[model samples]
Target: MYSAKEAVSANNISEQFISQMTIRYLTSRKLVFPTKSILDEERRINSWLGIGACGSITYGRARIGKTVCMNYVAESIRNQYGSREMVIIWNVTDHPETERNFYASILMAMGYECPRYSTALILKERVLNELILRAHETPFKKAVMFIDEAWKLREKDFYWLMDLYNNLSGKDIQLSVFMYGTRELKDLKHSFKLQGKDQIVGRFMINESQFFGIQDPKELQFCMASVDKLHVCMTDYEILSDGLVDFYFPYADGKTFFDISNDFWEAFQSVRIQKRIAAEDIPMKYFIDSLVICLNMHGKLGNSPIAFPTRKELESCVALSGYGESDDEYTK
Candidate 1:
């Protein structure tokens, strides 16, 4: 196994980058902030039973800390539980988003051969058996399943996850499964009872779920402080507490910490890349707007450029962004 540092330095934004970034992102004593409250509840879970399976919900909204909290939890679990423990993050956007593909990934991560078959149900059953076998046969059998962007998962995928837990229950296999995303999973829970709604209302940390909320002001400060040293350059972090954090607090009403932290890091890195600047002297809004221009033009758009946007391209990018025009701003 290569060191995570060496894995990150190598080309490509592989899972290693996600792992590296996750550690840096979550460990940031200052920048990652606190609304998650995830770390606390996770401690109460039983490693063997996965009693506190982080629900398969992302807590989608505007300012919620879904992704940020998951990042923290993933690192914490990795730190606490050794690397031999399985920690796989299945992104719905990047994969086939089907039950079969999902289970195949699980099989692959578990170090068990993925059966060459089309039926997910079969693979799911076989994998559960594998988990049991691995736990009982091995002395240090600790495995964790991490599902990110889980809200986009189809119903079949969700049911199988529940079934996997249900089958593994009462065994000493020691499974720690955490699902993170947005309101998408919460809504699905209305009809499904994997963890059961009673446990939630009754105050028991039932079903391995640790719901999060807006971070506290202290956590906010700590998070900002922590990330400042790890990444290139960042300054003057601001939280739009008034907007989504407050106004949209309900109905999975927050967008999680991804938007804010992503904004901060991208802008910070841009400052480092664009011009030779003193670490202390970062133009906040200039860097932010330029960063946004890159986001608008390069990211989700079709046939976008490979490199990040330039200072000159930003003006036209912004001007064309509102009009739903991509060509005028970032075209060849």
Candidate 2:
């Protein structure tokens, strides 16, 4: 039979163990690590907002973190400007390329029900009124829309978007648009230019940037450093004091993820070289996936101490990340 003090101590240990496991699970499932790409995209978008541009295009390959970057930017804008501005993210779907569908999509994105019986004119009015109401809530009377998967939109769609832009302008509300899509979006811009659709090009595609993943060893190190210092916060509490790296490898003598970044980068490059993939961009999805794999493989979970990952372990992690397999599919 345990004494009262001993029972309390055991209970405390059990609670700590449960909390650690919970954090590990949460981090594995969903963790947002800041990246340079997100910062650069934010800067570009802010510039567009500064100049009052109608819209701009941001194109990248699939899974390069464009959507995540846009998400971060939208949140940043909302936080920075607060109630002075409105930010909305609309994901363009592969629906029919018609004015009615376009307006309906916008209405849906704004969290409004789109009745199938409503005509295009009614949908247009509903969208405009919604925007105007939202914009009026803010002091600046400004609204920004981010169109994700924008390559799904055809040229005719832009004319409809332009009509909304014009109507919002007439209402004295400033609407700035930003389109995020895959490489096909750039192709669409080129096609429009070749077809001499200067109006659409000038309004939306004039300013553009290509998004990339982890580009070089330096960038990989930066990202790893971010992970090393990342503190998981829940309900205003910091769960992991030393981030995931230290949590997993508590006996590594203070080694962090940054210490193994070079090895990880080399391992990644080796895998790509062996697979004969020419692309150098390391998609964030696989990068984070690989890190999570490593954590699961070596995490001590407060039971025992573990060492940091070696180059061979990291190589296995990268290979298992499905980076090579995805690259093959992408190339084909």
Candidate 3:
């Protein structure tokens, strides 16, 4: 019944005492650390659902973790509303911009297989019926679909979606389509507007939000604290009674990841400045990558113990993360 930190202290454990299995679990598992961007996006989605808005778009730069944020928000919505709503996450793939492919994608996302010989009309019917059935399970008669990689969708795809939206309304089920994609998604909306596709823009693009990376030291600290608080687990069992920070830096004189945010931020800033990259926000992918690099390089697994990472060490980790390398041209 001793807490993780207490157990570690009681046993006088050292970095070498941590098991390889625990390290593997920590490195391999998918961990969702909460962030301000995620919370804000969740709130905006909740507001849209509360008022029964038709749809909305969430766009951000590549590697900023828009997909992760949407997935988190989808789960959050399901937990909050329980059986009152049906949420589906559709990862839009590169396919022919045809109505048949569109309807087939929806069916596939909902865990149903589409017959190869099925016509677009047949697939559309199947999708509509399936959605109606799911909507009927909930008293609210609501179905929400998050379209990830939505920038791949074309104008014709939006018209097809509009048809589905209209059909669902006819059946008294409110369908909320939330699109999560890259900056191209915002440009897509503008493209639609210029073409006078007002209805399409009105339905899905009216209420939109842009996702961003860690904007400053404060935000970086928030994300670091979140990682510190996360429980390192294997399936349902906790490997340690204490959180990740405590387990990794148990002998750091009680200094937590929160206290090292400045160093982390400065390290990233130093890398950006040296690279002459103009992007101010630290992409979430690279941020997390840098963090994992830190943990693996300095934690128990690496057999190198430090109370916290030095600025130089952090800068090397950030550079190794390839934070500004891939998207420099776009950002510039």
Candidate 4:
């Protein structure tokens, strides 16, 4: 056994060692999915609104890359629409700000320069004016104001949104608003109260996307390959794809890829540092144990609604009696 200091000076250590592995893997280049969904929800949005001044809302479980996806969508919009500088993306969940304050934030994101009025209603109107005024300059004038973590917005906020849509109703200006978050913002419309205002709910034509399930088979293999990249010698094994996919999601549940990477890094580092698992001799037992540790740290063990005995599930046979059934099945 070597002391912490002595281990550093020791030779033949693995190259995967890092001074600080506590940070999220977003900092480690995990956010860039080499291939992304080209048009995340554009087809659907435009399909819903054929004429002009359309709107869309995207919703999904928390930490499932909804924020990142929305950003990608915004970027794509900007790229397609050359004068896309008009589009604004605003985040409104931090510090418990209300819809009014959020309007102020949106105004700020849209380059609101007027210092004349500071009231909520005034700010909202002024923001509309800026967009309206810009649209008159060029027919290509368009803006997609993406409001993130919008579940925090109460029903009262819907008024401001309605006003926004109505204001831009009759102009060459196109306002495509994108709202995303965890709320049953979908279910919010079905409520008896909101039913009274069906027209209001009809404004955005919200679309829902949930990441509550395991990754697709293709994605699972890619995820494992990404993890394999962290290893200098540990090659990616395809034999365990089905097993690992279940393990990862049920363990990390709805976490993003970055979250899973960070989560795995921390758990791996903790187990290796605390018990001093050597670089070369790290066993499969320790690897599984570290994964279990990550599951525990991320607060998601029993949270999984499904379970499996890897031996029985993977090999399709009981392990009892020297895995007698497994042996017989293998022979056949």
Candidate 5:
């Protein structure tokens, strides 16, 4: 069992290794796109899970696929452990604004009953008691509590986390907390110091994974290739060997998927060049949306031997969809 750092450094990926890795580990009954960032985040979470009862934070602006990446990691961990029962992943995305509601959310995720009008103390007790019971009776002894939208947590809510952390300490069932939020999460941390909550801040600082959009041309290529490798449900054909760029309606000349991917990459670069946006300005959401739109367009070719978008069609879709818009503008 290699540490996360060891695994990341050891599995350093190059273009040559991606195909092999994809065929061996990523391909299954469903599509599992493995990029460098996704793999690195998985390794870090796995390492923290092994160590147990720690905290990690993944923060970036919205639409960077932070939650999506975490979902992949959670599913991968459950599958690798051979039993979903062995690892419980609770996503607290719509968690309540209050502490009691927060504890209620955790209790509900664990299937613990919390009667109406239950006090915060009672809710906390129920959660801790259930965790302890699971350690002894259930096969799953480890848990991951994901606090998405963590920036929404108020100052008093920090103590709620501290209480949960303290209660879980010295117990057989180790837990790891992952905080997912935007840049404001760090500001929340800084405000904690003013409130003299250094310990809570320290707990969350154990590991920080910075989520990002496409940062370079290489990453853009990697992401596009990952999308290109995405398997369609209908056919048993191998896109890796034969792509649909030229074969599809927009370009019936039958260019390869790699060729199509190169075209998509160039379109993004073209946006940067023509719009004068920074080289790294492309957002992950825009890429995802563009790919989805292209796929939907390709799906229009029902029962066709190949399904893909031409360079011209892809460029048109991305531009029309406003994928090249700046993050602030998109957010607004």
Candidate 6:
């Protein structure tokens, strides 16, 4: 009877240990690394908002971190200039197929009281008037509007947007517009070539940044360092080991945690060099997702700690991230 009780207790402890080992303390969503791509976008946005009466477009492959870059830059700008002075309106144009919907979306993001009963033309005027009114205020000096998923914009929507841009600039409202989308934005701009949409085409073409991902070696290193800053830990071990520092959160590579910087960068290079992954194929989002997945996989391996991602595993993560197939290799 005593032996059986001891056996049951041991099994129970084993189950609890497994459960604790599998717990992931970090996620990609929580940590937004300011890589080169993000920094470049930030600079462009700052310049646009700084001068006023201009707009910028950021387009790239799917899951390339364009939206994240925009959000991070906007937040940074807002922080620098208090909330009252710098207003950022974000609208994800998922199904905003009409002009009124676009206006309503912007108004909604700005927290304005938009009546549903109003016509699309009224909504457009309302948004423009609101911007004009804010421009007159002492506290409001700059307003930035971010329209994500802008590839869904139709030809009519382009005219509507151009008109809005013209109206806002005409009022001298100090407005900076940013559109985020996929490569389709380029196709849309091309369509306007002989269609007499020169104004709209010129506005976007003037200040456009193409974000493919981190391609340069130095930039790659910087990205790895940014990942290190996240400092994902084994929370279960932190609690289980009590006050002992040594037993708390062993390195994923079984070495020092900082080794992840080189390990991740090297693994990525190997995959790309072998042609298993292309340079353009590895975007910021996939890299981030792969890192998070690798970290969780390492944490799950109870005693065996493999520090960095294996090529196969990394490739698999990229595949799962929806950017598996190489569309085109980035050229110098």
Best of the candidates, TM-score: 3
lDDT of 3 by residue, 65-156 (tens): 78888888999888877852388889998999888999999999998888999999999999998888877777888889999999899989
* Shift in Å, residue 3, candidate 6: 36
Cα lDDT, all candidates: 0.46, 0.78, 0.81, 0.47, 0.62, 0.61
C-alpha TM-scores of all predictions: 0.46, 0.86, 0.88, 0.54, 0.73, 0.74
Better of 3 and 5 by lDDT: 3
Segments in model 3 whose C-alpha atoms lie over 4 Å from true places:
1-30, 234-238, 303-307, 328-332
Q: Which portions of model 5 show Cα errors greater than 4 Å?
A: 1-32, 86-97, 111-114, 134-140, 228-231, 234-254, 273-281, 297-310, 324-332
Worst 10 residues of 4 by lDDT: 231-240
Q: Rank the candidates by lDDT, best first.
A: 3, 2, 5, 6, 4, 1
Against the true structure, whose lDDT is highest? Answer: 3
Clashes of 5: 3
Residue-wise C-alpha lDDT for candidate 4, range 163-269, written one tens digit per residue? 77677865556777777765465556456245687555667644444322113334433443554333111111102122223333344344333334433334334
Task: List model 5 lDDT by residue over 1-332, tens digit each.
Answer: 33222333565633223223333332332444455677888898888877764778888777666767777887887676654544445555644578788788778777667689999888888888766665444355665666677777766666777777677776656667778888888677777778778787777655787776666667777766665555322113223332223212344454445556667877776766666654354566667667655544553333332345667767865775575465542331
List the candidate 1 regions with Cα displacement exceeding 4 Å.
1-58, 62-65, 93-102, 108-122, 133-142, 174-176, 193-217, 231-332
For model 5, the local distance difference test gives: 0.62
Residue-pair clashes per prediction, in order, are 33, 0, 1, 0, 3, 2
The window of 10 residues in a row where model 2 has the poorest summed lDDT is: 232-241
RMSD of each: 14.8, 4.6, 3.7, 14.4, 10.5, 7.0
Q: Summarize candidate 2's per-residue lDDT along 227-248 as a digit string, tens digits.
A: 8766533322435344565446
lDDT for position 234 in model 4 = 15
Reference-based TM-score, model 4: 0.54
